[model samples]
Target: MPVRHFDFFTAERRLVHTNPISLLKDTRLGIEGNHWLRKLLQNHVKEPAVVAMGGIPLGLRAAIERELDLLK
Candidate 1:
């Protein structure tokens, strides 16, 4: 079995990333939540754009679903 583990780190201050690709490449790409990966991606996205793309929250939801689909 692939033994999975999780841990969390809180920067003294919140960190923001304008470029997610670079952020992902950064070694600190770790999170505590089971959906941390998805949450991180959602956080980097500007909320206004999310609302503009569609009044619904489907964009991130779709992205998250797509990611999970690929994992399976």
Candidate 2:
């Protein structure tokens, strides 16, 4: 699949709830109007699934998106 840039403004802010065995559990990384932040997490985290909403950034999102494959 082609890696498409996420629209921060259009995107929804949320959290990613993980299991006790999961290090990502309670690790908040969701936000709106901040594509960079979402991208950053999308790249780094194994499964960048939103669990809750919060403040997000652009640089961070970009970083995450860059490492998205690595997360997989």
Candidate 3:
């Protein structure tokens, strides 16, 4: 058996090639960011004062409540 020398750097003084990859995106993580924005607008709908004061189109209150369905 013969021993070989290994050099960690090139003449340019940069790292020699050793590939290490990263995962930048994945499908399962989408909803980990998905819901909060919608929840913000729905917040106003949950408040009785805002709803009574005409929470936008008025019909939106019912829709938001249906979506929340918290007890179930």
Candidate 4:
């Protein structure tokens, strides 16, 4: 899965392509309640390419964690 890393705080806000699984885990652990991250996930949901690559962005990761917590 291809993951794109984006830094909104930067002047250019360039995207850095990376591996999706590692990126998702890092974002899930590092960032919390970030609207930009959430927006990125939502935008990806509409496109088949993003979803096809097993894209589980911050929002989905959070949701999965929440579900696991509830199950516990």
Top-TM-score candidate index: 1
What digit string (tens of lDDT, one per residue) describes model 3 on residues 2-72?
12222322435765655432332342333222343355455544555655676464545576567546422
Which regions of candidate 3 deviate over 4 angstroms? 1-55
TM-score, every prediction: 0.29, 0.20, 0.23, 0.24
lDDT of 2 at 37: 47
Task: State the lDDT of candidate 1 residue by residue for 1-72, as single tens digits.
Answer: 322431222233435335635444436544344456545465743466654676545455666677556434
Least accurate stretch of 10 residues (summed lDDT) in model 4?
2-11
lDDT of 3: 0.45
Error of 2 at 36 (Å): 1.0
Write down the lDDT of every candidate, Cα atoms only. 0.50, 0.47, 0.45, 0.50
Prediction 2 global C-alpha lDDT: 0.47
Number of the candidate with higher TM-score, 1 or 2: 1
**What pairs collide in candidate 4?**
none
The full ranking of all candidates by TM-score, starting with the best, is: 1, 4, 3, 2
Candidate 4: tens digits of C-alpha lDDT, residues 1-72: 323443444436645455545445534453344654466456543545555676454356665566456434
